[model samples]
Target: MGTRWTISTPEPLPADAVDAVDAEIDRIDRAWSRFRDDSMVADMARQAGRYPIADTDQPLVDWYRRLYDLTGGAVSPLVGQTLADAGYDAIYTLRASARVPVAPAWDAVIGEHAGALELREPALLDVGAAGKGFAVDRVAEIVGDSFDDFVVDAGGDMVISPRSRGLRVALEHPSDATKAIGVVSVAGGAICASASNRRVWADWHHIVDPRTASPAREVLATWVIAPSAMEADGLATALFFTPAAFLRGDFDHHREGFHHVTIRRNGSVEHTAIPGLELFL
Candidate 1:
């Protein structure tokens, strides 16, 4: 949601076409924003411990639950508590700080759902990954009926249709914003790049690993391709919490329509089993 929007219509769009797409995007923003007061997700978070039986929120809850399991609790909504402890208590300050915050307990804490989320716990439900990708997916659904080809860039995450020659995306250097570490092509589905540099506040950013309750080390960025924007979204965030040693194993296990390219702190690159993965550059 922090990213901008760029539309490549197969043909020059009528002025109304732009307005319509913008309206649809705005609608998506209202429904899925984590910070917007009117957003459905915000409402659910506000109700947290109050909703025991997941209904509409079930998909997200179920997805988060799985991540909680798969990563041994490396990714979580409960990371809110960790953020507060590290001084990222509010949105305004977090936006201002632009720092990668390490979870105070990452080395020791296990992120398994201790129990159903409880309001009493000093935890926060930060849906940084889920929010934007989900919004992009929703936008695609809304626009699919009208436009056959389009790309939605929600921060660094994206989803595109094969309507274009091929979707060319740039991966920003983790330490340097102006330079692109590399570029990748996405077509027919979704691709996302999650990095430590996108948003930092006081040396702290929103991506938090529930395990050990801190920031993930070693990998600077992970570029992933998946069947859905949502999957790519979660996987990219998951990469932040995972170790490079485990990269191959994870790819082999879940590798399907997915491909990945990762940049290390030293500026070297490693890729998953994605075919012609180097073609994008």
Candidate 2:
């Protein structure tokens, strides 16, 4: 959510259309942003109680629940406190705490009951893994209502609407932003990427492994393509901890609806054989 975004269409969007998109972004930030003290998630962190869940956020909550179980707790919204302790906090302090605490399991801390999120204990919920992608999809839907085709790029995570010709996207090298490792043709759907290179401070990065309360170091970068940006974004981060095969086998839709590529610490590349993706090295 702390990044720039661009909306591409054949023609310039109407002023009202642009405004509508901006309004939606602000709405989502207020609801889910951990960086903002006034955000709903921040309020949830302050006290343990049954908080109302907006209908718009139902998909996000559902996705978080699914991802948490799919990856066996590797991906969690409960890591907000861990990230803050590790120096990625609300004020962007980038200063690690004396001791960071391991994230609590999802079931141990939070639950959903009667259209409300019940928190057993106060905890910071971070949805950076997939919130952006979900936002992209929502923005795309708004854009789609006015235009037949469009591409919504929220930083590197994107949602491409159906187009006459697909767009060719370059996969940036995790270590060197100036070099591209490969390219992929995206006709429609979502493509989301996650890497350990960005947001660094004193031996820590943003992508923390909840299991250890530490940054994930095994995989340098991961990319995923799915029917929705939310799925792609969540899966991109999950791939850091779970293997592609397990994800594909565990979820029936994932077997056919998802494709991924991962760059490991050993400088080796591992990926699913998909027609649109091409790697140079």
Candidate 3:
């Protein structure tokens, strides 16, 4: 939620429209942000009880479930306390705490429920992985009719206007933030990047494998392009633990259309051959 988001439009957005968009962003943060107060997710975390599930928050719960299955629980929306244990909690002005919080069981945090969405455990949920991408997608949907060509970028997750000519996108180096590992031209759909080094504090970064309750080893970053930003965002996180090939299903034929670039810790890179897109190193 600390990331900066930008909405680029070919035409100027009306002042009221801009305010409306900002309000929507704030609303999303309030619903999903565990670090902040009065958020529906945060409220659930505090009380650990049943509450009426907000319709807007349903997508997050749904996506988390899909991602949990996709990555075999490697990426989840319910790793808040694990992150806090690794010193990724609020009050960042102070040094990171060494105490490790237990990573909630995926079943405990997001088990099947017939009626409504509820947190049944002492859960601290952080949706940073794919949430921003979802937000980008939502904003794109909200503004689709207003603009002919535009890009909505939140951190590295981007939703670009559909075009025949691909948009040149620079893939940033995970270890060295200033450098580019590769560049790709995106033809259509949304692109999201997940890296291990961006939010380093006390020698620890943001990404933590829910299984080990520790930082994921190897693989600097992953980029995924999908028809939907939410899917792209979730897949980007999924690619962190598993290889790009695993994301393909029987229905996908050979390619998942999920072009991924995995930058190793040693500075080497491996990327899938995406259809209609070329990578330049």
Candidate 4:
């Protein structure tokens, strides 16, 4: 929630539209920000118990549900409370806390309810994984008619549309922030990257495996490029914690397109299984 977000355009906006767009971004920041005092998320969490059935914010909740099945429940809506217990509260800022050993699939602070869109157990769903991506996607949707060459980056998740030159995206090294292992060219659509090193705390970070209840320390980072930012966002989160054995080589075939990169803890790049994906490197 304290992450920095940047939006860029290759072309200048109309004088009249600049102020409007800037204002929209601020509005979005307030609505989407968890740190805001009157944030919609806070109200929702408070009112969840009284609702007919607990549910997440629209479009995102729908998207999360879809990806949950696709990733075999590796990603879930019931991870919010458990994540907080792991030192990731509403704020991303880290604080010193005693380390609690998580037994396999042990979540200490969650309750069962039918509020989740997906009928899952002990779920504490948090949309942090996809919230930034969705915010960028919303910006893209709002400005889609205005420009073809534009990019929206919330934290590290991004969506690009090329009106002229193609998008050149760099893959940040998982271990070294200033280093980049490879650069991927994106012509149109979305790209999402999840790193274990980022948003991490003292032996505890943002990434949480719902089934495992323990912080996943295997892979360092995973980058996903897909047709929609939502899909890319969800998959990046899922694959970031997904065991290597479950993934099909470097990439798995999707009904749409397949292009991705995974960086191991040791800093080696794995190209997607698709034949031409090597070109992204």
Highest-TM-score candidate: 2
**Highest lDDT model number:** 2
Q: Estimate each model's TM-score.
A: 0.73, 0.96, 0.90, 0.75
Clashes of 3: 1
lDDT of 3 by residue, 1-281 (tens): 68888888878887776877788788888877877878877776777666655576577667777678778788887788778777777655324555665476688665453346566675777888888888888788777767768888888789998888988888886767898767778876889988888777766777888877777768778888787678788887777787777775511532435666777677677776765444445
TM-score of 4: 0.75
- With candidate 4 superimposed using the best TM-score fit, by how many Å does residue 106's alpha carbon deviate from the native? 16
Candidate-wise lDDT, in order: 0.61, 0.90, 0.75, 0.63
Per-residue lDDT for 46-153 in model 4, tens only? Answer: 544322232323667666655565566667755665676676766654653454333222123223324432221322346777777776777776666677667877
Which is the winner by TM-score between candidate 2 and candidate 4?
2
Candidate 1 segments whose C-alpha is farther than 4 A from its true place: 11-49, 52-57, 95-123, 163-165, 243-255, 266-268, 273-276, 279-281
Cα lDDT, model 3, residue 33 = 82
lDDT for model 3 comes to 0.75
Model 2 lDDT tens row, 27-118: 99998899998988999899999888888778888888888998889899999999999999999899999999999989899877347889
Candidate 4 structure lDDT: 0.63
